[model samples]
Target chain A: MKTKNMISIWFFVGCLLALYGALILAAGLQTYSNRRSANIAMQNLHLQGWWGTGLLVIGLFYVIRFRPRRLR
Target chain B: MTSIFSAMLARTWAPTSLIAAASRVMSLGGIDLTIITLYFFLVLGLGLYLKKFTSTGEDFFMAGREMTAWIAGLSFISANLGSLEMMGYAAATYQYGILVGHAYWIGAIPAILFLALVMLPFYYICQTHSVPGYLQLRYGEATRSLSAISFAIMTILMSGINMYAMAVIMKVILGWNIHFSIWVSSLTVAFYVMAGGLLSAIFNEVLQFMLIWLGALVIPVAGLIETGGWAGMVRRISENFPGQDFTHMWRTLGSFTGNPMGVHWTGIVFGWGLAISFGYWTTDFLVVQRVMAAKDLRSAEMGTIIGGLFKMLVPLIVILPGLLALAVLPFKLVPETMANVPGVHTYNEALPLMLARYCGPGLLGLGVTALIAGFMSGMAGNVSAFATVWTYDIYKPLIRKQASDQHYLSMGRWCSLLGVVVSIGTAYLVMNFSSIIVYAQVVFVFFIVPMFGTVVLGMMWKRTTPAAGFWGLLAGILASFVLWLCVKLDPSALRLVAFSSHAKDMAENVYRAWWSLLANVVVTIVVTLFTKPKPEEELKGLVYGLTTLPSLGQLPIFKRPIFWAGAVAIAFVLLNVLFW
Candidate 1:
């Protein structure tokens, strides 16, 4: 019974991360280029996008796999 | 003329650097603001939603022990990966070079494994809610009370330091009133923690962990790309520092004489690795509480192991940028930001400036949010731990021992709110002492060094008496204070402790930990021999010999905790070799 509460919490956190990830991912993809800035930092929007995807995938995995298995 | 890096990197932003960073974050557009605002409100909403579940003290403090390994592990490390750790350590790397990696590598990995393999079994089997509870069982009430008081004071001070540091950083970045930033951050953390207790804090820490990695990981990627990848950065670093040992981790570690860290492998291996790391990772309540909250022994142990694994990779984000800043940030940042101190430069601005320099509009907002998340997560970790220790160890035992669980739950919420208020007061105190804060900060290392000695002896040996534990702990703390005082009086006094001539604050800290631990162990041993030990029945499941140790005989070899520990330790040794 207590497991159900934690599963819900995990699901909630997973969904939030995925949604946030998707937002940043869209912008990152939109800014896709070799160097996103000329400020000597040379930040690649592409790599930034990859992290977004990583968070998204991990979040999705948690929500999917940790979904509570109802008692038989 | 001093280097250009000194000119460009102001020693610290009085009001201007804050404006600059605020402008950088502000320029990221309204979409960024909206996202940050929504994120804040969502966290608040989660806290409110979880309030329904925290009906008992157990639910409030431990989340009813329902946390999976992943949740516990991420929360475990996230609590320690506060934004200051990012900014502070980045600045440390900027100033000290690659040697700081020892703090994460040898300093954390082994101790974490030790906790998982040896300590977690005892903690879980005995059902101790907090580190102090372990003391009560293993030693007695006197030792437990003493530790609980010291740990209580220590945790709150740390939480305040987090609040003060973040407030100062944000104030420097956004030009916000320091008091205003303190109140706002403290209230936000206090609110969420009060509403949902540890469950809310853990959930947010997991969220914050993901956000921090997402935002922070960009600095290295961007820096590497611009610097022409790994070889380019290294080549440029060599060119920048010329003959100075900027990237060597172990080559110069053979001697404490002329090294940049001013200490040899003895300091790293004994001071940091065994004493400091073991004391902190094995016994410190802040991280240990997270481990204890896991659903079961396996989850708790695995959570610590997972944290160790993640700990191994932390340097790339935290340290690499400081190394990159050496070559890429140009020489002008130094002279531009040079403070009143002659020949000194402000490197504390490394992480924030890195964020400002690289991350574009959308990504910049994410970065700002990540910084905010880092500070908030740190604040929450402290407050919840404070609340738990206060309610369980201090208030419940001393003030009202027989209170109903429901009564204790309310007190837990009340304590969370009160802890933030205390942190705010302490934060103000810190602001006043910003210049010589290093002296005050010695409290953190001192508390742990002595506590570690007593805890290590108590857990492993059955002969350690209650009187011995109490006296040893008290003596260790006082001894640490005296050592630090001598070092502070005459920086030259460090030589008496065998510290190198070129020793800096970090070196002093390393040696101080070592001497204190040895002193603590000596005191404990002598006292234990003179006093009567607890009988066998009381020591059951508390000491190694008396306890029926958990075995993984039925599990497959790969599924065993030892398998993971071996994997992490092997990787640890290989990394040392690779860097060596």
Candidate 2:
């Protein structure tokens, strides 16, 4: 595949992951507010919000900064 | 932890931890849900995106022969690393102890290396799209058709096992609706496989491999740290499960009477390592299709070697979790938790229980998603293999000998969905069998054992006739089922049987495969003596001695396939000795 198409695919992957991450983080907010709904292990771990943020960062980096150098 | 999921022909079943776990996760909104949903979206995106790049039969079925060694090698093993494997190996190790590592080490390493060094040249040179396609050239249309039909059925049945395991386990643990889980898995697999075909399937498998490794890594790391390391973990297992051989891989293999696996060295070495392993690694179309998609012959061969190296480490990920669970996880659930879950008596819940103890929420989501990915990878692998065999080997030859490449390409897509639809029936069908993984292996034995004998004779001997191949394969299949049924009729009949039998599931599997292979070889030879063989000129490019293979002699030491093979073999010996 050409570099341009490769970049576009990765770009799209990045966007999708980042979008889902945000939604996950938002759900965690509501979950945290309702103490009855939240499980202690999950609440103690704080899984949703942080992993979502991590996904956004990873995806954004691939979308904006990553590039491969051509071989000699 | 789920049920033992084993179908012993003894009909012993165990309950899983699915119901209790699922209720708890549902209360927490099932963190697995969020991660899994995103994962599904990403997979569909990839399949749809790759669809544009896949237009012809070659591209859809074989990735247009453009994959690198890295891609091919990872995809090769990934296709085999489904949830059934991850959970099954762990559960087996929990029950059988460290002897289960043989499945990865001696069982896999040699066969993979042999495929790289010996078999790739013929397959690549002949350029058959399917393993059955090779049979057509070496044997005849009857042999190929039998193979194609049996293999097509095998793939769908195997996928059905995966689907059933995922749905059943999810329902019992996470309290998800079973039909919903099945539909989600089936539709997602069908969508991608129908859209991108094999390339999409291969690409997702590689992705799943990465996720599986990342997801599973935490369990061992956390368990070891908590237990204070490998030595500590071993010490605990010995203390908890007293008088059990929990750590040694080969130390107790002097006889079938004592080892945890209950198999003597003959069964371990000849039956498992030689017969079953070689049959699976060398000839099965599900995995071989991935290798055939490589960019070139060198890459294809190199890819298998690389895969072998990775395979040597797989036991550490899958089996070690079971050992860890044995050392630390609770054998019985607390009463409060038991209220939501059914009771069982076994170590089959080792992996998931350990996962729950080790991973919190985020990591839990990732870990569970890894398992889900494994389920889909297995389903996708079977679906894609079924499509290739159906479209290329069965449909094209028998139904329409003269169709456009486009027509076949369309047929391949439709067949991918058709295969998944058939798998739904099979998924329900396999539920009647007790254990998902064991039943799957039993299915493989009927096809692979006898099929291996036919392929080996056809490829190595010029005198092997097509009639010999057909009759040999048929006889072998018949013998396997008959032997199994005899054992089924009387479970105690195993001791009266030959080839080493301690009556355990794993050992029983080894002996059956050995018997099948022996029958296949003897029947083929006996039949060949009475029949006329194929002509010498017709055997060119198919038989070993007749075909002039591209020599690897000129390649540097580091680049040669033999060098890698030697390196892997030495490592194999070291592992056996170290574990011993």
Candidate 3:
């Protein structure tokens, strides 16, 4: 059961990573076609800023909500 | 004329040189004037006030270990952020790309999360005053002794690197000589750290944190705006690099071969975040002091996590500016040419220099003030940690047994004074030796790796014997030294260079430092597994019990999504890593 749980978790993570990678690959291609510089990529990242903040807030909530049963 | 010449000669040898140089430098308009004035008085005031706090060893040394998580978290950030992060990351980012973000993705997030989740619980359970004390509990007195000595030496070397780095920045930015800059910075930092201990250190960091943000963040924001907003920056970046892979975080400009001396992604992620972070979060007195001082275990744990979250935004401030600088300024005639231009020597000075020249006065002054503030924050943290190590780790156990709290606190104050003097002396050595960032890395690789091995394994495995602990630690140190020798003599390692003409010489030294950490970890694990396990009595409170978990203690459950969130975060980071 534990092995199954662990494997499922890994699978879910693998898929998410694959998705993120795909998006970046697409972005990279677009950047290349458009002849983007490193700063442009960073600026684009800034322009699309709140993604990380949302992820973080979600992550924080998840960690807090699922805290260990015996915790003070 | 003859009499006037004699008088001038006498004045040259007089102590007034520092005062004269300091005042003349302070006379500069806008940014510099603000820095000099703020630096001069703030540091002096901190030192005098510390006189009151210095009455006992406990008070002087640990601030009686009564600090909050926020203070501890801030000081930890300040200590690590230093000029290196300010200057080095910015320069690196300017030259490289979002690839530098790999540092956050691979090293920082996981490492800090692991520190909080995996290690902190055990420290609270062990309930020791310091990492060394925890060592004594898990490994025995001999391992504790060895661990303490190594930690102290590393801290001194690190303080030296930090002090020198800040001095260099001040000199370059303000057009002061290295010698004059060193004394001015060292004296002021020493004063408040001597007076306040952790209290002053923490207080200064809250202020310093703001400065670091300004110097690092404000520059990038303004640079982006000046260059024509976010879209304009993107437009500019695409225009220059031409058909480049900018979106992927790991694969960016100049990252692939820029650091041929071997600080690649593996090193930054695994070596820096995993190996180095474990040692720092678990063992380093700077962070541990805060955890020990926390109002409760949960608060301590939460504060560290808060700090980690704050660290997530750091690269945005520090590294991005560096990348921006590289784009904004044309590829110069080497680092020295850029450095000699009064704004570009070290990573810390890069942003301020850019802002001063490019941005208007008010903004430039604010940026310069941030750098000074960052320097002061770093210095304050170093002094506080030195005082703690001296008082708790060294003085109380070795020097006196029946000393009063007041007496111990007083001893702590005196210790802070001595710490400042020693640190200043050490900083002078760093000034003559290497850049602060490189020096800090060398110290990290050689000194920290072995300590990490003992502390991590000792906490996890109940069967880890003191005999194993001592031998593992000894072997790790010996192994790293031997590794250092191999890298030092290697021909390929000798081929690299830094910004100086003496780059080849310094590169060889750094290569030795880098490779040694890999050797230390390998030898430590091998020695540990082969040796005997710790006795049950020694292991009792040290390792986690199957039953008594800190997070699970008496808390009612919400339909907690935290578990699912943790799972998702893992997914997100992996996706970022694999895809980007």
Candidate 4:
């Protein structure tokens, strides 16, 4: 009998983070253009873009490393 | 009136305290909604996909015992990292200052290490499906039935409480309707848990742990930067509170009057650190079920140790935000009583208020999603545990004893669905009488301390007879329940239970656990002296002297469970001293 390979939980985590990172990055760009925010502190830092980029990079690494593979 | 209108329009732009007084703290924008929607789809989809793997009773209830140490470890800690706990501890820190940190450190770390080192061997070696299953193996059917019924009731009600808490938080923070929040989140959890069982719950727990950190880490980071770092934050707190010792963990704990919590060091060390912490960390099936899924005994031990390591770091995300709120927020936060009055914020709002202070649209959504993940994961943990206990310990033993593996598997899945439905009903019931939450806590206190005593004595002493185990547990539980009633009927009775009139409600709980544990120990020991012992052959693998623990002599010293546990112990000590 041929056994099926299970999808890694990390891969799912990576996908979620990657997608969220992209959306947040786009929102950050929009925030930069609007020059308005509800946040009280560190508004000039544009934390959304920086944090989003970090998540995207880390997420892509996990995706590449743990993506599901065909069982031999 | 103009300011209130502006606060309503601008949402988070206004001061958190002011906005909380007038309306919801923050509104979810399109980006935030997208993030949350994506989360639901991902969890549900994963659950459906994993359904094929869960064809057997083992797979449904125990994740087929195939998880690696890392997976099991993350899932172990995450099961306990529910949003209710997150918010409650944070609120505690806000109310009692850093004294609450004792719960994370001394109150938890020693017990977790003890579980990995002392208890996991018996549990893993015996191959019991649930905690009550272990009880049945050691004590008999009577003990198992009592434990299973109480635990089953507790888990379902606790799941309901989590659902209600999530809905209330959503209503307070985002102005979502309570019914909409409860039903939608509960249904999503029910579907996933029913579809994939423990495996699905484990996967979501791991994801929720990550999300909780990602969402909450921003608060301390931003707060530190704004205050110039920890020293600066401490300075600001001292400046703000004047004579208060909010920054010290142990210094003010020497006297109940000296601390905001009205708890002395003895209660911190003996009551919380010894009794309550051990009772929960070592015995609670909700977290233990996660570790039981490990691929091997070594993995189980390693997973628990790893969980302890991670657990030490949780304060950064949960407690720091509360501490930061004391220093950073411009206004005082009233208790729950005055929370509804305009211009007054409650201690519970510390985390959300901090999120509002730092996170704009995109990040705000991530933070909200993390909280939602926490609530769902909590529900999933409880429901999954309930299903396992109900099917294996209750239904199989009591209802039908001769069912096939397939039948049990089907029952597990159906129980998952039934548990969620009951939890939803419980959530609505709590909406009418909120005191159910307090009753739930009282019930937890009654069971956990005594159960811990029964299990530990049964595992450590070969002479502990089944009758002693059952009667000892009953004595402890009855003593605790009576003590609790005494305190409730006459508030002055707290002085006797807690050994001081200044002891607060928090202290009362801790001291109650200690007294109950003492009652159990005394009764168990006396009964054991008179009762006949089980034969050595029957006691093998379950008791300390009869069982031969696996040796790690061949493994590298650094890779040994003992080595890592020691390292964690040292770190735990350092943290207590650093914050002292």
Candidate 5:
């Protein structure tokens, strides 16, 4: 029962991540036209640049990796 | 007439004895100014009307958890928005650029989403009166007690600064002494809030938010037009601060000291938005109270998101004004302009200054009233939340377990009055702090982030033991305080030890302190994961409803979408960093 519950919670988290990913992708595509220039230096980018992209992918994976385990 | 106006301004604006003398004479017949008096009556009337809702403990304290989504959303915004955010946003926008504006967009929206999609489910399942009530069910007596105490302390400290911010404005505008302004501001709100409990608070807050929105937004629009349109305003600013990038959305991240108003980067933008939004949406009682007062879990969830939508429109009211102020004043005239205004100083006073100067007499009075409304509503919110925790979490359980519901309801009001006095007194006592905006931002970073561990773990991970929750909360807080001490001690501590310190360096960048928050959450979660899970019986009440019978249904599409919409909104807002 506990295992089943854990699976359910993870499944919910996964859904949130997937939704987060989709939104990021949509935002990226939507704003791509408006974004004419990316002026960041490499060092700055290394520190925090891919934040949007990174968060999106992580969110997507969280949803994808989530699965409901069968109740013990 | 010009002499009278200047004399009046001088009386309020002048240093020392002359200012006080002028304040006394000017205030002789100004006791009941039209706009301020009308607002005072309005607050009193609302409390009287809400008296019907104050019959029961639940009714008075939580509005019977039945507020509509719109009211909940508006009241939530009003309660927490306060003078702190209003003034801070204006100052930041004046000095920096739209990067600070992203705070509302990224943080507020995502926070609402988390509350709607994530936090709501747990609240619905647990069905506790207060969020800490949920803690009691999830952890135990000690955890609940500690959380309640910590929350009360935090609310007092935070509210104390908020009171100071409001009192400073009133002190300047009315030419009242600091002590008089503090009492007048504190007592007016306290009286109404004491009458109706949370119901009165919610009632007045709806009106308060309307005034706050109008005063903050309309002043900027009028100022922009007065300074010539957006193009004119921009042209004027560029000419003075030549070649300074005033268009970048993420400029702070580009250079550590990069021209914040120009060029681009996302470090501070992302940092502030992420920290404030998450903390506010999930942890802060002032915001969480509105969610707790929802008629049902869905209402609570949806109400928070609706508030996020309102937040998205805030920059139009707040951030734009600073740019307008900058454009209107000549570069050399900036200091003189500030000096000329009797009650305006710092970033918080910019909006007030714009209104007092540009707005006509009737509208100027209205604007002043709006500022007062914003402040009183914030005070009422703190008092109400403090009282709720005190009555429900402390007094009922510890002081009088057998007390009647009516007694508890009455106790709530007394608690609110006590909270009001303590907050006002604390504000007067702590006059030597940094700027209100920085002070508010700093407090939230240190105090709130550590709680993310307990809240997130409590909701998601059943393997989180009670012991883990207790120890995690304690350790996380300890870690943050230690970090705070380290920053103060690193150079100063050595200096003190050697008796060689003359001038101290500015403390570490706020961004560095924010990293401590992240560390606290990690430590709490990692510790929780390693501890033995709670026994199933103890966990069942929190993990699932205690109905003893099961009647399950499908999840709503909007519930999920509503949550996603928040995340989507935040992402779009972050994309603004590109314009940086």
Candidate 6:
């Protein structure tokens, strides 16, 4: 009998990071539009948007690459 | 109540205070809470999904020995990378300057390499389910029982301490209810571990490792940017504290009074670099079990080498942030005792303080989730290890010798639940009587050194008798306890153990471990000479001279364990010299 492959841990990690990235990116866009100053240092760099985009890209790559496939 | 528990933890670990800053508590925003909630859902989902694969006893206890090198390697380090170590070492860096980096480098790397290149083959060949199982094979049931019982008690108590510490941190940092944090986290861990066992634990540990890096990485990056770079940070620290060598790792080690930690170079080398480091990395089943789950002998060795590499980088997230806090944070951090005053922060608050300084809403949530992941993963590691040892070493052998594989699997699940419950009980016990934490530390110190001595002797020397292993371990424990009591009764007597009047509690610990290990080795040698040795035939496959080590000649140098270990060693030396 052919054994089924278990879901990769990276898939879960990817999904979580992707979801978090999108949420953070939306929040960042809202903050940017409102032109409100956050209490954190280096806020003007728009780190939220940058970091969120980075996470989204990496997360999406991991999700796609490690996604479970049926064994033949 | 939270402050009291924090104070107790501060006292137990010493110098690295866990007290909250006197400033207002930080609360999570909606986005942040959502990220944290999603983590809970994901872990539970993973556990439920993995249940079908965990039907057999081997699957439940060992992940069916099917884990790849990467999975096993990441989980191995993650199991040790708990919130306590992260927070404590960061705080240590803040207090003692860069000298604390020695713990991550010299204190860990060589021993980890030893485990990968030398010790792991024996464990892999033996097919032992746990460290105690290996002991039973090398010695006898008596030795196994002693090690397993002590380990079980220690693990559960440690899990409880981790639980309580996390709850207190949550209460102090986020103003959450302590009971709510404890119960929610404990029940979640227990449920998932019961469902999927070691596989579930390993999966979550790998995820936690990633979360920890991403969440905590922001602080060091932002700090470096703000303070220029490594050179600028060093200059700032020197300017802040005049006439002090806080940036150099080895320059201040010539004399005990030369460094903030009051430890000499000898203590760092023989005591920590040899005894304590070898004791933990080689023998601790919690981390070793992860490697034991690897798919092959090469996978196990490669996994350990992988762990050693990541361990070398952990200083970036943990130690560098503490250094950054000293150079960049606007407010000065006092000791835990002085943290009660307004605007005063404890050294332990370095990590969280850096988090608040650099992280805004969504990022703040991610950082907090990373800490929570660390705490839960630590608790899960302890509970899972405890369950396995209890079922295999204690229940199966001592209580019921004859049982079906399904029966043992059922017992393993029940023990996992029971371990969590006991850990919760230990948490409350600590809440009432905080001194138990200090006692637990002393007891742990007693075990590790002696156990390492016994195991190493048993494996390398075929003439070692079972009686020698048992008695030698007992002698080491008693000798360590006596030394501790002497220091307790007469503080000046610490010189006997640590070799100097200026040596602090940390130095005393390492020296004490070295002495205990020496006592164990000497007594084992003496006892072996008097007692009848195990027959050479019986020692086959277990003893070094009698066993045939596998040939690695066919594998390429890049794939060999020795080659990677050499790479790790070179990196280790470069790091030491660069910091020196």
Report the lDDT tens digits of candidate 3 across residue range B348-441.
3445545553433223344566666666666666667766666666666777767777776777677767767787777776545544434344
TM-score of each: 0.91, 0.88, 0.73, 0.96, 0.75, 0.96
lDDT tens readout by residue for model 5, B1-580: 0000011111112122222221221121131255467567656766765565467888878887777777787887777666546655665566565555666666466666777666766766666767678878887788789888877876776567567655655665556567776787788778878887887787677777766764455466566656577778778778867877565565444553455532223333433455435655677666778777877666666677777677767777777777776777533222212454443344434566566544432344445666777778877887888898888888888789998888998898888889888887668655654244344334445556556657777777677777777777677666655654665558555233212233111113223324545665676667777877677777764663322322234776655435546565765666564454
Cα lDDT, model 6, residue B50? 85
Which of 2 and 5 is ahead in lDDT?
2
Q: Mind giving the per-residue lDDT tens digits that candidate 6 earns over B1-580?
A: 1111111134425321344444544778898898899989998898898888899989999999998899999999888888877887787788888877877789889989999988888998889999899999999999999999998998888788778877877777787878899999999999889999999999999999989998999888888988899999999998888888888888899998999878898888887788878878888888899999999989999999999999999999999999998898877777776756776777777888889888888888889988988888888888889889999999999999999999999999999999999999988988777677777767765677688889999999999999999999888888888898899899999877888888766778778878988999999999999999988888887889899987766887898888999999999999999999
Q: What ranking of all candidate models by TM-score puts the best one first? A: 6, 4, 1, 2, 5, 3
Q: Give a tens-digit lDDT track for model 4, residues B1-580.
A: 0000011111111112322455677888999999999999999998998898898999989999999899999999888887767776777788788887787889889999999999999999999999999999998999999899998998888677667767878888888888899899989999999999999999989998889889889898888998989999999999988988888889998787999878888988888888888888888898899999998888998999999999899899988999999999998877765655976777778889889989988899999999999888888988999999999999999999998999999999999999999999988887777677666757765687788899999999889998899889898888888998999899899889988888767778788888999999999999988988778898888999999887766888888888999999999989988888
Q: TM-score of candidate 6's chain B against its reference?
A: 0.96
Best by TM-score: 6
What tens digits encode model 2's per-residue C-alpha lDDT throughout A1-72? 221344333445456556645655666665667654443332455555665577667667756754433455
What is the DockQ score of candidate 2, to 2 decimals?
A: 0.18
How many Å off is the CA of B255 in candidate 2?
A: 1.7
Docking class of 4: medium
Residue A49 of model 5: what lDDT?
Answer: 19
Which 10 successive residues of model 4 chain B have the least lDDT summed? B1-10
Instruction: Please give the interface root mean square deviation for model 1, in Å.
Output: 3.1
Residue B502 displacement (Å), model 4? 1.7
Q: What is the C-alpha lDDT of each candidate?
A: 0.77, 0.76, 0.53, 0.84, 0.59, 0.84
Candidate 2 has an fnat equal to 0.06
Fraction of the reference Cα-Cα interface contacts (below 8 Å) that each candidate reproduces: 0.31, 0.06, 0.00, 0.51, 0.00, 0.51
Model 6, native contacts kept = 0.51
Count residue pairs with overlapping backbones in model 3: 44
Error of 2 at B286 (Å): 0.2
| CAPRI-style class, candidate 5 | incorrect
Q: Given candidate 2, what's the lDDT at residue B497?
A: 50
